[model samples]
Target: MGSLTLSGRTALVTGAGRGIGRAIAIRLAGEGALVTVHYGRNTKAADEVVTAIRAAGGSAFALRAELGEPGDVEALWDGYDRQVVEHTDDTGLDILVNNAGINVRCAIGDTSPETFDEMFAVNVRAPFFVAQRALERMRDGGRIVNVSSGAARMAFPEITAYSMTKGAIDTFSRTLAQALGPRGITVNSVSPGIVDTDINAAWLRGDEEVRQAAAEVSALGRIGRPEDVADVVAFLTSDAARWVTGQVIDASGGSRL
Candidate 1:
């Protein structure tokens, strides 16, 4: 079997300051990709990730842009362009992982219009625009992996808006794959189940009972870890997944089955 490596490639992973995004950035760097670690507001966490990568003999740098805000996508690429000029002469990218997202859980009755708009803006609009602009600098045979959630496939009325946003991402990936196929670019989505991250710590890690209940949702009988989702994303970003595109790979550990 061939090994997975991203030597000589450049990758940009959004929300890399912590959680799944951080894990993804580190994993890609370990595989030898020159990584751009993006953060929304946590520059320190992002810098720490970059420092760790560089200390491990990998190349990485941190970029900042708050998604869901006006002009966010352009600001992100502006940083990317500047960093590319400073780090390498190449103007193309090899991988783009749209891993940044927000989840606001509320019942249909409690979901306000403001919250609904914010969720869609951050979870759907940001990624869509990011990919649209990224294609211009993405090389042939490059990969785009959208981080989706099991909530999109299963019913989660408590987080209806959040789930809806992920569904949109799945569609975006499928349609984009068809659009970019002629250029040999692959776009896919990776949907994960309940993962133990800062985002879910409030509930999943709050009590043993809650944690175990979350774990039981998966056949593995354990709450998913950020690394679990990150590894799947790494595979999809690698050339090994070149033949795979426009598909939503479930990294959900047999949830909702």
Candidate 2:
């Protein structure tokens, strides 16, 4: 329905069942990319996304794989491969968005070893392996966008472990871009701040004071919408960003500026 900049391309977006990932999947489909919507366990939600895309005259399919679990990456690819063959008669990917992650609201003092490990496994290990597998199926000029967070740059004691994981992702994006440059693949990370999604609903919704406080953190003086970050990701995946790689684009509405 838009410019169709990514027409005929194939994309896979992890954690696409809801939130920012959902928005990214839809946006990519709108741009004319056949999208694979990866979900952890929400079959209904994932199906809804695919249906929405199809209803909009775009192509999409849902894949289920719980990230951070054993053999998760392999399972995800297996499903993707099957779908690709069925839909496009090909096996290579044009875009991969590592957007699935979990947050643990705990300071160092309150963080246990189990908590730390789980956070890293889901937030860091999952994306690392997912990308590793994706590269095998990615075209030479493919795009890889890792979803990081502004917490990685700021001192967010409330989510210390979560921030640490995002730091690792930022490093991964930069280093991977250097390694994949020769192959014409561009890798980048996006950092969003205080987005208004179900993930933040518990703290940001139904409370005017809390909502205003969060909005005030950004120079824009308003909370971010999922589409805000989704648009940035859409840009990075397009040919317009062919020369932009190994960078972390802040989609935080100037938070902490």
Candidate 3:
């Protein structure tokens, strides 16, 4: 909030209707970016995020794209083109945040093939294609932040499929960063630990034992807030991280260290 780090930039954040995605959208808007809040099914939540940004004197809009399905990337950009034309008349985007994902808790023994496929479809396939298509519309020197999970590095046997998907994301970011480096584009992954969002509220809030157990996983001795990860993403998108790319920045509060 001190300086308009992203002033005049246009950002697209997927799965922004709630949870960590919502926090990133708000944070980027606060830094003066024109944000497009993308949601899959929760139109009401998406609208609320737009409303909150507008109320804060920021520019924002909402778009929908059900990721992991056929033509999902195309549908997303179709909306993006119209919105950008109506709002800024700019043809290029400055920031792309792949924050839309799903996690299913299932151990390897009980994991179904269908569940594994769906996880890869949404978490890995969707984001990969989204970046591929977005490259056509992304301006030089743009930033792309892929939302990964600490589970990629740490062992989460209960959610093996989800963890595997995140590992794919980390690799995608690293490889894409090199591919886009000549154009001044930076691609990086931000891996966050357990955050106190609606997604984790079931076990993170109002349950003293559960909350404490989760907190103890991190060196910080507390569960992460949405804003905690948001701030890290904002920094990566800003000029401050201009030289940083092809790296996985773990925003996990020094877990297991």
In order of appearance, the predictions have TM-scores of: 0.98, 0.97, 0.97
Better of 2 and 3 by lDDT: 2
Give the distance in Å from residue 253's predicted Cα in candidate 1 to where it truly belongs: 0.9
Any runs in candidate 3 off by more than 4 Å, and if so which? Answer: 1-4
Candidate 1's residue-wise lDDT over 1-257, tens digit each? 43569999999999999999999999999999999999999989999999999999999999999999999999999989988777777768999999999998798999999999999999999999999999889999899999999998999899999999999999999999999999999999999999989998787776998888888999989889899999999899887887899999999999979
Residue 32 lDDT in model 2?
96
- Tens digits of per-residue lDDT, candidate 2, 1-257, equal 23339999999999999999999999999999999999999999999999999999999999999998899999999999887788897999999999999986889999999999998988999999999999888999999999999998988898999999999999999999999999999999999999998888887898999999999999999999989999999999998898999999999999998
lDDT of 3 by residue, 36-123 (tens): 9999999999999999999999999999989999989999999899888788977699999999999888999989999999999999
**Collision pairs in model 3:** none
What is model 1's C-alpha RMSD? 0.9
| Cand. 1 TM to true fold | 0.98
Where is model 2 poorest over a 10-residue stretch in terms of lDDT?
Answer: 1-10
Best by TM-score: 1
Give the candidates in order of lDDT, highest first: 2, 3, 1
Sliding window of 10 residues with minimal summed lDDT for model 3: 1-10
Cα displacement (Å) at residue 58, model 1:
0.8
